[model samples]
Target: MTAASRPKSVYPLGAKAVRILVADDHLVYRIGIRNLLGSEPGFDVVGEAADGLQAVELYRKLRPDVLLLDLRMPHKNGVEVVRAIRQEHQTARILVVTSYQTEEEVFQVLQAGAQGYVVKDVGRETLIEAIRAVNAGTRWVPPAIQKQFSDRVLRQELTAREIEVLRLLTRGLTNREIANVYGISANTVKNHLNNLMAKLDVADRTEAVSFCLARGIVKPEEI
Candidate 1:
């Protein structure tokens, strides 16, 4: 018989199913994932969360074997949620399933304690494999994402103040305005810009903003 036609009992007897928690803002995607995983014999989606807050709450309540999380969500982004869950439960296993595949986003979530990262465009088999791997206590970042994460790690990281300046720069704010916002001098703001630009390897504020946006360092909505 074909794989799709195979019975659910095809797996070896006594194999325990992997419990999963699906967390995403979209209703349709959640349902789709539920149905897809439901069809698999060795997977059981125990709970669903519509937002990051709900995701954390559900994880606390359900304590599933694996958490399938979305990178972007309301109330708390994936990174914050991962940090929160991992803070309380160090053994938590989280797999980020997001539409975004930017190096910065992948690195941030993984650094925050997620075990794996996969884009939503992946095939069903790949997604299932990621969940199983995470459930088995293995990191599941794809080779391309791993390379991107490594590249981001090798680069000089920006300071918190520099990141704030970059966010303001994306809004077309003048150096003087940014300085006033922070109660600092425009010359001080200029120094921050110079430092950030050098670290980012960009020529000017415009290029810096573009680079940040493209790499998911600073989101467009933050501007």
Candidate 2:
């Protein structure tokens, strides 16, 4: 069913139902999630949002007990949405359900105050468990995701300037062009590149860009 035609609230058949707001860019995914959650005993799928902005807006209106958010949405990405919602409602329970599994994506959303992160391909039971866990004020990160996140935490982090340089590198900018963009010398740009490459554990600029792209640290559209 279309989001517009779907029931605004599914009455709970059990005591103390968990109200949920589903947000994703894809209509099919939203419908699928709504159906899946609606089948559970204590779930009340209260609303649906088709994009990040709508997600934020709906959260304000519905105030669901749990929000199932997708990481990549128009108007605002998951990180931005989490930060926006948490800024207004510190106790908001958000669970990121997305296909993106890159360490950077997971870390960014969690840092922005998401209570849980689960890949889209997780089993139905796991997804339901995560929602329930987050609703009960617990942080949920699957074992594999937690391990990758831990590994990323142990590695050296890239400085803001270094990350900026990396983005420019992905755009195929030359050292001179990048330096000019930042009002720095070519030598300074080279220094940033070298530092970023070291932190990323890549051999050269090309490898650094490739690594960032592969790891979802720098998205192609952002370039």
lDDT of 1 by residue, 29-122 (tens): 9998998888888888999999999999999999999999999999999999999999999999999999998767888898999999999999
Model 1, 134: alpha-carbon shift in Å? Answer: 0.9
The pairs that clash in candidate 1 are none
**Residue runs of model 1 more than 4 Å from their true location after superposition:** 1-10, 157-223
lDDT of 2: 0.88
Per-candidate TM-score against the hidden true structure? 0.67, 0.64
lDDT of each: 0.89, 0.88
Q: Can you tell me which runs of candidate 2 are displaced by over 4 Å?
A: 1-14, 156-223
